[model samples]
Target: MYDLTGFQRDLLYVIAGMDDPHGLALKEKLDQYYESEIHHGRLYPNLDTLVEKGLVEKGTKDQRTNIYRITNRGQREIEARRGWENQYLDESATPT
Candidate 1:
């Protein structure tokens, strides 16, 4: 997670939520979340980054589409991030 860029983090979250997330599906979901069109130039490279980092595992869904899944490392990273975020959120809400 510390090694992950913002785009890679988003990709991890998206992959975790989906069963067999492919490029197009990932792009669509990201576009909706980002409220902008996700171009091929941006999406694929970030996905590759996740694969390189061992946070995501890639596989072919059929003859064409390549699917992605979050690995155990990815899950641990997500949990770590959530815990880090909770510390800030909790402190922010506490009376000064």
Candidate 2:
């Protein structure tokens, strides 16, 4: 997880937060958050990286779409990341 870039980390969190999201769906969520376009050349390769790392599983939903889901290892990594974050953040901080 620490070896991943911020964009990769964001991808992991998005996959974990949503139901099995296909590539375009993932792109849409990222666009909504970034308020800008994300190129396929950039997106697909990074997703492939996550796949190679065993943190995410990629499966086909249809001929035209690929769905992504976080692995158990991915979930554990997320929990670990949250725990690490909580250590530095004040517990009483207001939401947003």
Candidate 3:
């Protein structure tokens, strides 16, 4: 949660938003969101970090593909983060 880097947090959100996203799919989503290319060396290692932290699980989809999903721990963290954010943000707050 608080220990995760911003990029890793973004990764978690993207993974949560998608259905069993793989490396390339995650990369594409990030690229579109960031409007720039994401390097493999950067993406996979962070994913491995999430797996090691037990916030995410990695599973094989095929000979050449791997899928990712957030664990229950990860979901709890997301909820906690939302709650923490809501503490300072009014529910009806709108963009200027």
Candidate 4:
């Protein structure tokens, strides 16, 4: 897997958590997590990057909205990240 920016990884996790997640919904979810407004300038381009990387698929939700979904490759990448995190957690949990 390639090294992804924190924002890109967050986008992937958000998309993976939802079905047919639209841009607005993603913005809202991120805003809630970040406790600040997420501007469209930052959101759409990162989404496009995920699309270019084959980690996300974009489809028309309506005339003005685009929906996003995580691909199989994205899922595998997330799982790998989770596994890596678990290894660190396990190591931390071990008594010295």
lDDT per residue, candidate 1, 24-96, as tens digits? Answer: 9999999999999999999998998988888899999899989999999889989999999999999999999
Q: Name the 10 consecutive residues with the lowest summed lDDT in model 4.
A: 1-10
* Candidate 3 local lDDT, 1-96, one digit each (tens): 999999999999999988899999999999998899999999999999999999999999999999999999999999999999987796558566
Q: Which parts of model 2 have CA positions greater than 4 angstroms off?
A: 91-96
| lDDT (tens digit, per residue) of candidate 2 on 11-52 | 999999999999888899998998999889878999999999
- Ordered list by lDDT, greatest first: 3, 4, 2, 1
Please report the candidate that would top lDDT against the real structure: 3
The alpha-carbon root-mean-square deviation between model 1 and the true structure, to one decimal in Å, is: 0.9
> Model 3: C-alpha RMSD to truth?
2.6
Task: Report lDDT (Cα) of residue 45, candidate 4.
Answer: 96
Model 1, runs deviating above 4 Å? none
Native-vs-model 3 lDDT?
A: 0.94
Could you tell which candidate, 1 or 2, scores higher by TM-score?
1
Descending-TM-score candidate ranking: 1, 4, 3, 2
| Candidate 4 C-alpha error for residue 14, in Å | 0.6
User: Regarding lDDT, does 1 or 4 come out ahead?
Assistant: 4
Question: Cα lDDT of all candidates, in order?
Answer: 0.92, 0.92, 0.94, 0.93
Q: Give one digit per residue, the lDDT tens place, for model 4 in 1-96.
A: 457889889989999999999999999999999899999999999999999999999999789988999999999999999998999999999999
